[model samples]
Target: MLVVKHLSGEYEQRDPRTKAYATKVKDASLSFETFELSQIGRENNGRADALSRIASAETQSLTGSIYLTEAKMPSIEKRECLEIHQGTDWMTPLKNYLEKGILPMDRREALKIKYRASTYTIINGRMYRRSVSQPLLRCLNTEEQHQALEAVHEGICGEHLAGRSLAFKILRQGFFWPTLKADASEYAKKCVQCQLFATVPRQPPEEMTSVLSPISFAMWVVDIVGILPTSMKQAKYCIIAIDYMTKWVEARPLSAITEEAAKKLFLEHIIL
Candidate 1:
């Protein structure tokens, strides 16, 4: 039996304007001509003359010698071989085979994903592993690296750094805790950014007063304010309040400062 083996090489479609479709091969651009019996006398009792005669009779174009080979039947367990003819397109057959389930779809998908994932450019001449989350080339600076490290650390702690308000605070202050070396707990505690921005300030408990203030409904403290408006459309008047003991301040907006309106606004905000 005669058999042919396909070679592995880069293949590309030819341009219609520059190349003839009839002469162009699918998947490859190289020209290929079928040779005469290239193998003979390598099999048991194989005659070189007989093989050459057979080749001549089969193709009628004998341009090469006839070599012989042992008849090794293809194994049933072996995967189907893809015959990539020289100067002939193999993409159609390949696509057919893939669509018909001759080729494993899952394996092909996995291979495609692997190829896409591996297609990444190096940064700063340093070989870092490719990943979807990896920073782009232009953004690969010292500050970006610090941010990335911080993000990774935050992610490990089950938090998303980018979504957190404290992220801007931490980045603006340029804070980094030495978690990898020395005492991580102590380092985190001493981080100035973490203390001033990331962490909420802890207020000492207010001292308990022995006497209680008399209850006066709607008789609440209020603030009045006026300022010139900027370019943006915004009101100038504002009000703020503070608890007597807690000292926590709350600010609100006010349109007018009439005595009756002020009393009603104070009652609505403080009492209600």
Candidate 2:
């Protein structure tokens, strides 16, 4: 029933997000003789939610007297920014031309800078180039380009995309460099994992997944969804059964996870 694991000592709450709210609840609970917290689904809690909304919305419309208070400040502190030194790179000429009208002494180069600056704009000290599909593409300096390449190719959520695809993906994410595609290609070529997992043996049109054939509506998998908000009927969990081959799914809301509840759902929904 306890959603705040740290407050109940079930587990140490390391998440700053929930821990802050949970701490306030724990402090307030001292005023009560006995207090308990339970999670319920939105379907059952809609009545109370609607009441709160009415109390907060259009107070003038309601003849009944009501007073509301709003929090003036954010719950979390502002994120800290890291200080880094940024030296000039290929974009310097374009940025200078656009911001300050600075141009190279060479007449030929100055004309080129004017043409390039037409495609770029500075926003809050950051440069962005005009894009057709996207409104703006963020211009990255040398250091930032490296970070972007590493992040897109090898960072936590990275899929280790090949050279050309990796470059396009970074562009899609609104980042750009003078040699983005070339750099991405070189970075991918140097990546250890990319080298190890390089696509090979072009016999089949696509890489084969499994040799064994699977039958439709045969094997199934079951999973429990959560300790959700408690419903008026006291249900807070969802049990789901999915057919692997057919991709058919069935679900039932439950108050608690139990063998009998699972069996009941299986008998009623899946087996039948």
Cα displacement (Å) at residue 230, model 2: 88
lDDT of 2 by residue, 1-272 (tens): 35745677787777887787777778789999999876677789887787777745787786655556675665554557988876678988888888899999999999998888888899999999896668799999888999999998989999999899999999989898889989999999999997788886769888779533288667878899999999899999999888887778998999988999999987888779
Instruction: Note the residue pairs that clash in candidate 1.
Output: 25-87, 25-88, 26-88, 26-89, 38-67, 39-67, 39-68, 40-67, 40-68
Task: Please write out the lDDT profile of model 1 over residues 1-272, one tens digit for every residue.
Answer: 22211111223425443233323233243434542323334565456556656633655454467444544752223457999755422222233343342443588764654453343333454322333544332212344445554554353552333233433334333432212223233334555555566756467588666633354331334577676353243556667765545555666555655677566655776667
Task: Please give each candidate's TM-score.
Answer: 0.18, 0.43
lDDT winner: 2
lDDT for 229 (candidate 2)? 94
Q: Which stretches of candidate 2 lie over 4 Å from their true place?
A: 1-87, 202-272
Q: Stretches of candidate 1 above 4 Å error?
A: 1-220, 228-234
Let me know the TM-score candidate 2 reaches against the reference structure. 0.43
